[model samples]
Target: METGPISAILDTTLAIIFTWVGYKTAAIVWKYTPYSYPNARINAMEAKLLSEQRFNELAESRTLQNFVVNLEDTDYRDYLTGISTYNVEEIERSLERALAGTYELMIKILPGRVSPFFRLMLEEWDVRNVTSVVKAKFRGEPASDYVMEIGPMLPKVKAMAEAKSPEEMLVILEGTPYEGPYQRLLLGEISIQEFETELYRMHYGKLLSYALSKKNDERVILEEFVRLRIDRTNILTVLRAKAAGMDSEKIKSLVIPGGSVKLDPLIHVEDLSMALAELDSTRYGKVIRDVREEVEKDLSVLERALDKYILERMGELTRFYPLSVATPLGYILKREREIRKLRAIAKLIEDGVEPERIKELVGDVA
Candidate 1:
């Protein structure tokens, strides 16, 4: 039977639609299937994450010795058991080694195809390593005896550790995307805070760009996660700048380009208190608002809020794609919170800050 032109067009359109649906379904299945075994291990790891109660118990310890004894009761035991003293550096290196172990495990278990995304995620840690070395160099301190020593960024980290000063560090970073910001720092055109802000922009920009390039479940989750982080960074940056009495224009200048919020309203205000007030309507405002009084008392509270916010967002995304990259990534992010919060507790102990105060502040994460 001869069909009319409209009927033939409808048939072709239906065929195309069905083909796209089938292709997408297959792609999703393919993307997630390889992660099944990796995620089972991830699930086991996630199940072992420190409960709020445990963090509290550790925080309640009366001395650094007590905290170490308490820590020996958890998964951190294997990583920290050798530590006899409570030095902050000793604690940080042990915690970071545990983290480095996780990163290595993930890189090994992850399907080869998924390496780039995971590697990009590790860039955040690399940024921290570089900053740590830079600050140590400025203080005339020796390079950190401990570096993560993993991932493709290892060479860069090694080079940074070898540099004797910030200028030397800038020379190592030259020709990389991060060079301009560090150079500006060396030339006194930008503060370390501003330089760190640029590192974050470059990191998220790289992750978001790659996430946008892929067409899959992982991309959807990653893209959303990256943009959420960008928003978090912008929010905190604006708030801190305003509090510092930075010029309104200069405050805006530090705003990263690809965030999810319309922060212009929050960033444009000259008054710190007013700028924070303007934050009431943004997506991440609740974190700051929930701890408003504390944030007012100590600006560091906002930093902790944002870190928890970022980790919470990762957990939420992991639930959305139960069998994908988000699962392992979630474990890594949560473990990081555990490590960072632990570091804070150790630092407090080293400073002779009371355990009750530590429990009050550093016990758990959002």
Candidate 2:
């Protein structure tokens, strides 16, 4: 055989093997990539069931008995029916259980790959649970009651609840994404509020990384939504800090990165007007500007505006991307908000608060 021909044959054989391996690997990935079509119909149906009218009616019911009776006919009946008393504590417990149930349902329906996103969403609950545990441990109070049984973080949450000290709680978070923040908390390097912010930062960072790893239109929408959420969070934090008379340096330290709003202008903001001016050019500028007057009256008003803006934006994304994960995500957020509103109404009614006042607090679901 000629030497040149033999070399060429060897090269050709190697190329064919490598090409076949690449093709097979890609085929495997494609087979398990989790297309959004599997849950499209389910997402649409769920969104329809979360109508504003349903929430409005729940909010309108004057008495606990009336609220329970009306709720029995809704999807939340399973969670609410178990409550035999109208006590605030019982109502809060029922609301927590209902939220846990919602997460369980979401995990069951979402594809395995898609489930991670929902799990990341559930990290909020985990952070709250951990915060409650840390506070309880600080105050020497029992915390097992506040631990939420949702997502993979539940084990860590349980461990933290049983922890005797902040250091012990930090140990419970070891090997998890939250370990770094918890360690900082143990070292007294960050306040509890700052630690909570760090947990959120970690969650958003993980979600952003996952979204970037998937190069698809659906992931693009998800990534954008995540960015908007980060922006909303940062804005709310700044507003709250300002309301509490915090300085600019402290406020800047609390602002999480990876949001759509640039950091340069925000870092120099010393007051509400300055913050509004800095955010005026961003996507949320118009909404914040519109509510500036109300925000001055009460900083909490700005928080509501931020929530409504994010919810409305999510709703828009769901409408535009009905066949993607956006719809399911939108439904999840809307359902969570509805649950919160319902819980608030139940609490107010249990406290004998005025009906008009309760309605004002519930706000417009639409």
Query: lDDT winner among the candidates?
Result: 1
Note the Cα lDDT for every prediction shown. 0.78, 0.74
Question: What does candidate 2's lDDT look like per residue over 79-137, in tens digits?
Answer: 77777777767767777777766666666776675677767676777778777777777
Please report how far candidate 2 places residue 62 from its true position, in Å: 3.4
**Residue-wise lDDT of candidate 1 within 1-366, one digit each (tens)?**
677988989999999999999999998778778999999988888888887778777777767778778887677889888776777777787788788778878878988776677677767777777666666676777765646555456688788888766777777887777788878878889877677777877888898998888777767777877787778777777777777788877887788888788878877776777877887877767986898888877777787788888777777878877887778777887888888888888888778877688877775434
True-structure lDDT of candidate 2: 0.74
- For each candidate in turn, give its C-alpha RMSD to the true structure in angstroms: 4.7, 5.8
lDDT of 1: 0.78
Error of 2 at 364 (Å): 3.6
Residue-pair clash count for candidate 2: 0
Work out candidate 1's RMSD over C-alphas. Answer: 4.7
